[model samples]
Target: MRIRPITRDEITELVDDLWLPFAGEMGDIDEYDALAEDVDVRAEALDYRRTQLDDDETQTFVAVSDDELVGYTTVAYSESPPVFARDSGAKVKDLYVAPEARGEGLGTSLLERAHEWGRDRGCARISLSVHARNDAARSCYESMGYETRYVKMDRPL
Candidate 1:
Protein backbone atom coordinates (compact mmCIF):
# COMPACT_ATOMS: atom_id res chain seq x y z
CA MET A 1 0.00 0.00 0.00
CA ARG A 2 1.10 3.56 -0.67
CA ILE A 3 -0.07 7.07 0.12
CA ARG A 4 0.03 9.99 -2.31
CA PRO A 5 -1.80 13.02 -3.55
CA ILE A 6 -4.79 12.08 -5.65
CA THR A 7 -4.40 12.48 -9.38
CA ARG A 8 -7.14 13.95 -11.54
CA ASP A 9 -7.70 10.72 -13.38
CA GLU A 10 -8.03 8.80 -10.16
CA ILE A 11 -10.66 11.26 -8.95
CA THR A 12 -12.74 10.60 -12.01
CA GLU A 13 -12.50 6.84 -11.57
CA LEU A 14 -12.74 6.45 -7.80
CA VAL A 15 -14.61 9.30 -6.12
CA ASP A 16 -18.03 7.74 -6.27
CA ASP A 17 -16.90 4.33 -5.12
CA LEU A 18 -15.07 5.92 -2.22
CA TRP A 19 -18.10 7.88 -1.11
CA LEU A 20 -20.21 4.76 -0.80
CA PRO A 21 -18.29 3.11 1.99
CA PHE A 22 -17.71 6.38 3.73
CA ALA A 23 -21.39 7.12 3.63
CA GLY A 24 -22.16 3.65 4.90
CA GLU A 25 -19.96 4.20 7.91
CA MET A 26 -21.68 7.45 8.74
CA GLY A 27 -25.05 5.78 8.22
CA ASP A 28 -24.23 3.59 11.16
CA ILE A 29 -24.05 6.66 13.34
CA ASP A 30 -27.75 7.55 13.25
CA GLU A 31 -30.66 6.65 11.04
CA TYR A 32 -32.49 9.89 11.75
CA ASP A 33 -29.93 11.91 9.83
CA ALA A 34 -28.58 9.30 7.48
CA LEU A 35 -28.10 10.14 3.82
CA ALA A 36 -31.32 9.90 1.93
CA GLU A 37 -31.67 7.18 -0.67
CA ASP A 38 -32.17 9.70 -3.47
CA VAL A 39 -29.48 12.15 -2.39
CA ASP A 40 -26.70 11.15 -4.83
CA VAL A 41 -24.12 11.97 -2.19
CA ARG A 42 -21.08 11.08 -4.25
CA ALA A 43 -22.08 13.04 -7.31
CA GLU A 44 -22.59 16.21 -5.32
CA ALA A 45 -19.49 15.67 -3.21
CA LEU A 46 -17.40 15.01 -6.33
CA ASP A 47 -18.52 18.21 -8.00
CA TYR A 48 -17.81 20.22 -4.86
CA ARG A 49 -14.43 18.62 -4.27
CA ARG A 50 -13.38 19.10 -7.88
CA THR A 51 -13.94 22.81 -7.60
CA GLN A 52 -12.20 23.04 -4.23
CA LEU A 53 -9.25 20.99 -5.45
CA ASP A 54 -8.51 23.74 -7.94
CA ASP A 55 -7.92 26.24 -5.15
CA ASP A 56 -4.52 26.62 -3.53
CA GLU A 57 -6.01 26.39 -0.04
CA THR A 58 -7.26 22.85 -0.45
CA GLN A 59 -5.39 19.56 -0.55
CA THR A 60 -6.45 15.95 -0.85
CA PHE A 61 -4.38 12.83 -0.25
CA VAL A 62 -5.33 9.29 -1.15
CA ALA A 63 -4.26 5.82 -0.05
CA VAL A 64 -3.84 3.16 -2.66
CA SER A 65 -3.55 -0.59 -2.32
CA ASP A 66 -3.21 -3.00 -5.20
CA ASP A 67 -3.80 -0.09 -7.57
CA GLU A 68 -7.15 0.74 -6.03
CA LEU A 69 -8.02 3.82 -4.00
CA VAL A 70 -8.67 2.49 -0.49
CA GLY A 71 -8.99 5.72 1.39
CA TYR A 72 -8.61 9.52 1.22
CA THR A 73 -8.53 12.69 3.28
CA THR A 74 -9.53 16.22 2.26
CA VAL A 75 -8.54 19.35 4.12
CA ALA A 76 -8.76 23.08 3.56
CA TYR A 77 -7.25 26.15 5.10
CA SER A 78 -9.71 28.91 5.91
CA GLU A 79 -9.74 32.46 7.18
CA SER A 80 -11.39 33.01 10.54
CA PRO A 81 -15.00 34.10 10.19
CA PRO A 82 -15.60 37.71 11.11
CA VAL A 83 -18.21 36.94 13.71
CA PHE A 84 -16.50 33.97 15.28
CA ALA A 85 -13.70 34.07 17.84
CA ARG A 86 -11.50 31.61 16.02
CA ASP A 87 -8.10 31.67 14.43
CA SER A 88 -7.33 30.72 10.85
CA GLY A 89 -6.56 27.04 10.52
CA ALA A 90 -6.94 23.91 8.46
CA LYS A 91 -10.13 21.90 8.80
CA VAL A 92 -10.24 18.28 7.79
CA LYS A 93 -13.55 17.72 6.07
CA ASP A 94 -13.27 14.07 5.21
CA LEU A 95 -11.23 11.07 6.26
CA TYR A 96 -12.40 7.82 4.84
CA VAL A 97 -10.76 4.41 4.78
CA ALA A 98 -12.43 1.36 3.33
CA PRO A 99 -13.43 -1.22 5.94
CA GLU A 100 -10.87 -3.63 4.61
CA ALA A 101 -8.16 -1.03 4.93
CA ARG A 102 -8.83 0.12 8.51
CA GLY A 103 -6.23 -1.90 10.42
CA GLU A 104 -3.30 -1.07 8.13
CA GLY A 105 -2.62 2.51 9.34
CA LEU A 106 -3.86 4.25 6.21
CA GLY A 107 -6.01 6.54 8.34
CA THR A 108 -3.06 7.51 10.48
CA SER A 109 -0.89 8.13 7.44
CA LEU A 110 -3.55 10.31 5.86
CA LEU A 111 -4.04 12.25 9.10
CA GLU A 112 -0.31 12.83 9.51
CA ARG A 113 -0.15 14.11 5.97
CA ALA A 114 -2.95 16.52 6.78
CA HIS A 115 -1.06 17.78 9.82
CA GLU A 116 2.02 18.30 7.68
CA TRP A 117 -0.02 20.13 5.09
CA GLY A 118 -1.48 22.44 7.69
CA ARG A 119 1.88 23.07 9.35
CA ASP A 120 3.47 23.83 5.99
CA ARG A 121 0.91 26.58 5.46
CA GLY A 122 1.62 28.06 8.90
CA CYS A 123 -1.69 27.02 10.35
CA ALA A 124 -2.05 27.24 14.13
CA ARG A 125 -4.01 24.02 14.24
CA ILE A 126 -5.79 21.31 12.27
CA SER A 127 -9.33 20.33 13.23
CA LEU A 128 -12.09 17.94 12.29
CA SER A 129 -15.64 16.95 13.29
CA VAL A 130 -16.60 13.41 14.19
CA HIS A 131 -20.13 12.37 14.93
CA ALA A 132 -20.68 11.85 18.65
CA ARG A 133 -21.69 8.25 18.10
CA ASN A 134 -18.67 7.46 15.96
CA ASP A 135 -16.52 6.09 18.76
CA ALA A 136 -13.85 4.55 16.57
CA ALA A 137 -12.99 7.74 14.72
CA ARG A 138 -13.21 9.79 17.89
CA SER A 139 -10.85 7.38 19.61
CA CYS A 140 -8.43 7.57 16.74
CA TYR A 141 -8.43 11.34 16.79
CA GLU A 142 -7.99 11.42 20.55
CA SER A 143 -5.10 9.00 20.32
CA MET A 144 -3.47 11.39 17.88
CA GLY A 145 -3.59 14.23 20.44
CA TYR A 146 -6.87 15.82 19.44
CA GLU A 147 -9.01 17.01 22.34
CA THR A 148 -12.62 17.95 22.64
CA ARG A 149 -13.19 21.57 21.86
CA TYR A 150 -16.96 21.61 22.26
CA VAL A 151 -19.79 19.23 22.72
CA LYS A 152 -22.75 19.77 20.42
CA MET A 153 -25.91 18.53 22.02
CA ASP A 154 -29.08 18.27 19.97
CA ARG A 155 -32.66 17.76 21.04
CA PRO A 156 -35.63 16.98 18.81
CA LEU A 157 -38.03 18.91 21.00
Candidate 2:
Protein backbone atom coordinates (compact mmCIF):
# COMPACT_ATOMS: atom_id res chain seq x y z
CA MET A 1 0.00 0.00 0.00
CA ARG A 2 1.09 3.58 -0.69
CA ILE A 3 0.72 6.25 1.92
CA ARG A 4 0.23 9.84 0.80
CA PRO A 5 -1.20 13.18 1.74
CA ILE A 6 -4.87 13.72 0.95
CA THR A 7 -6.45 16.14 -1.50
CA ARG A 8 -9.35 18.41 -0.67
CA ASP A 9 -11.59 16.64 -3.15
CA GLU A 10 -11.30 13.44 -1.11
CA ILE A 11 -12.85 14.92 2.00
CA THR A 12 -16.21 13.20 1.70
CA GLU A 13 -14.67 9.94 0.66
CA LEU A 14 -12.30 10.16 3.59
CA VAL A 15 -15.19 10.70 5.95
CA ASP A 16 -16.92 7.59 4.71
CA ASP A 17 -13.80 5.48 4.48
CA LEU A 18 -12.94 6.40 8.07
CA TRP A 19 -15.74 4.18 9.29
CA LEU A 20 -13.86 1.07 8.34
CA PRO A 21 -11.29 1.63 11.05
CA PHE A 22 -13.27 3.56 13.61
CA ALA A 23 -16.54 1.69 13.33
CA GLY A 24 -15.41 -1.75 12.15
CA GLU A 25 -17.56 -3.70 9.61
CA MET A 26 -20.51 -1.37 9.03
CA GLY A 27 -23.52 -3.32 7.86
CA ASP A 28 -23.92 -4.69 11.38
CA ILE A 29 -23.68 -2.68 14.58
CA ASP A 30 -22.56 -5.70 16.66
CA GLU A 31 -18.99 -5.72 15.40
CA TYR A 32 -18.91 -1.98 15.36
CA ASP A 33 -20.20 -1.97 18.93
CA ALA A 34 -17.45 -4.33 20.06
CA LEU A 35 -14.74 -2.19 18.56
CA ALA A 36 -16.46 0.92 19.75
CA GLU A 37 -15.69 -0.12 23.33
CA ASP A 38 -12.01 -0.15 22.55
CA VAL A 39 -12.13 3.22 20.79
CA ASP A 40 -14.86 4.93 22.78
CA VAL A 41 -15.90 6.99 19.78
CA ARG A 42 -19.11 7.39 17.83
CA ALA A 43 -19.65 7.78 14.09
CA GLU A 44 -21.50 11.02 14.64
CA ALA A 45 -18.64 12.45 16.67
CA LEU A 46 -16.36 11.77 13.72
CA ASP A 47 -18.10 14.58 11.86
CA TYR A 48 -16.03 16.99 13.92
CA ARG A 49 -12.87 15.40 12.55
CA ARG A 50 -14.21 15.75 9.03
CA THR A 51 -14.87 19.42 9.65
CA GLN A 52 -11.44 19.94 11.17
CA LEU A 53 -9.77 18.48 8.11
CA ASP A 54 -11.23 21.26 5.98
CA ASP A 55 -10.02 24.02 8.26
CA ASP A 56 -6.85 26.03 7.64
CA GLU A 57 -4.64 24.52 10.34
CA THR A 58 -5.55 20.91 9.75
CA GLN A 59 -4.13 18.30 7.34
CA THR A 60 -5.21 14.83 6.18
CA PHE A 61 -3.27 11.69 5.25
CA VAL A 62 -4.39 8.57 3.45
CA ALA A 63 -3.18 4.99 2.96
CA VAL A 64 -4.09 3.63 -0.42
CA SER A 65 -4.01 0.02 -1.59
CA ASP A 66 -4.23 0.03 -5.34
CA ASP A 67 -6.72 2.76 -6.28
CA GLU A 68 -8.69 2.35 -3.07
CA LEU A 69 -8.39 4.35 0.12
CA VAL A 70 -7.69 1.90 2.93
CA GLY A 71 -7.19 4.37 5.74
CA TYR A 72 -6.84 8.06 6.63
CA THR A 73 -5.77 10.47 9.39
CA THR A 74 -6.04 14.14 10.45
CA VAL A 75 -3.67 16.45 12.30
CA ALA A 76 -3.74 20.11 13.27
CA TYR A 77 -1.83 22.83 15.05
CA SER A 78 -2.53 26.13 16.77
CA GLU A 79 -0.11 28.95 16.29
CA SER A 80 -0.96 30.18 19.77
CA PRO A 81 -2.05 27.14 21.67
CA PRO A 82 -0.56 26.59 25.16
CA VAL A 83 1.17 23.39 24.11
CA PHE A 84 4.94 23.04 23.73
CA ALA A 85 5.11 21.25 20.36
CA ARG A 86 7.28 22.65 17.61
CA ASP A 87 5.93 25.48 15.54
CA SER A 88 5.65 22.78 12.92
CA GLY A 89 4.72 19.88 15.21
CA ALA A 90 1.09 19.22 14.42
CA LYS A 91 -1.33 17.77 16.96
CA VAL A 92 -2.64 14.55 15.42
CA LYS A 93 -6.38 14.81 15.72
CA ASP A 94 -7.22 11.59 13.91
CA LEU A 95 -5.53 8.32 12.88
CA TYR A 96 -7.32 5.16 11.79
CA VAL A 97 -7.18 2.13 9.48
CA ALA A 98 -9.67 -0.23 7.87
CA PRO A 99 -10.74 -3.10 10.12
CA GLU A 100 -9.70 -5.66 7.58
CA ALA A 101 -6.34 -3.94 7.36
CA ARG A 102 -5.57 -3.68 11.06
CA GLY A 103 -2.76 -5.78 12.67
CA GLU A 104 -0.77 -5.33 9.47
CA GLY A 105 1.30 -2.46 10.93
CA LEU A 106 -0.43 0.16 8.76
CA GLY A 107 -1.11 2.23 11.85
CA THR A 108 2.58 2.35 12.65
CA SER A 109 3.38 3.10 9.05
CA LEU A 110 0.84 5.89 8.98
CA LEU A 111 2.33 7.52 12.08
CA GLU A 112 5.80 7.19 10.66
CA ARG A 113 4.67 9.16 7.64
CA ALA A 114 2.83 11.65 9.81
CA HIS A 115 5.97 12.17 11.87
CA GLU A 116 7.89 12.83 8.70
CA TRP A 117 5.29 15.37 7.72
CA GLY A 118 5.67 17.08 11.08
CA ARG A 119 9.43 17.06 10.69
CA ASP A 120 9.25 18.43 7.18
CA ARG A 121 7.17 21.25 8.60
CA GLY A 122 9.62 21.70 11.54
CA CYS A 123 7.39 20.05 14.12
CA ALA A 124 9.38 18.82 17.13
CA ARG A 125 6.54 16.68 18.44
CA ILE A 126 3.33 15.16 17.10
CA SER A 127 0.49 15.20 19.60
CA LEU A 128 -2.96 13.63 19.68
CA SER A 129 -5.90 12.87 22.02
CA VAL A 130 -7.47 9.46 22.53
CA HIS A 131 -10.43 8.56 24.64
CA ALA A 132 -9.86 7.17 28.12
CA ARG A 133 -11.92 4.13 27.31
CA ASN A 134 -9.84 3.34 24.28
CA ASP A 135 -7.42 0.91 25.90
CA ALA A 136 -6.08 -0.64 22.76
CA ALA A 137 -5.26 2.75 21.30
CA ARG A 138 -3.75 3.83 24.57
CA SER A 139 -1.47 0.82 24.42
CA CYS A 140 -0.59 1.59 20.84
CA TYR A 141 0.37 5.16 21.76
CA GLU A 142 2.43 3.95 24.66
CA SER A 143 4.18 1.42 22.47
CA MET A 144 4.87 4.22 20.03
CA GLY A 145 6.88 6.02 22.77
CA TYR A 146 4.25 8.59 23.73
CA GLU A 147 4.00 9.48 27.43
CA THR A 148 1.08 10.88 29.32
CA ARG A 149 1.76 14.54 29.87
CA TYR A 150 -1.64 15.29 31.38
CA VAL A 151 -5.21 14.18 31.46
CA LYS A 152 -8.66 15.65 30.92
CA MET A 153 -11.53 14.17 32.84
CA ASP A 154 -15.18 14.94 33.45
CA ARG A 155 -18.24 13.44 35.15
CA PRO A 156 -21.77 14.27 34.21
CA LEU A 157 -24.76 13.79 36.45
Q: Which ten residues in a row have the lowest lDDT in candidate 2?
A: 25-34
Local lDDT at 145 for model 2: 93
- For model 2, the stretches where C-alpha displacement exceeds 4 angstroms are 19-56, 80-88
Model 1 lDDT-worst window of ten: 12-21
User: In candidate 1, what are the lDDT values of residues 28-95, reduced to their tens digit?
Assistant: 77876567778777778678767867889998899888899999999899888789876789999899
Query: What's the TM for model 2?
Result: 0.72
Q: Evaluated with TM-score, which candidate comes out highest?
A: 1
TM-score of each: 0.88, 0.72
Q: What lDDT score goes with residue 5 in model 2? A: 78
Quick one: best lDDT, which candidate? 1
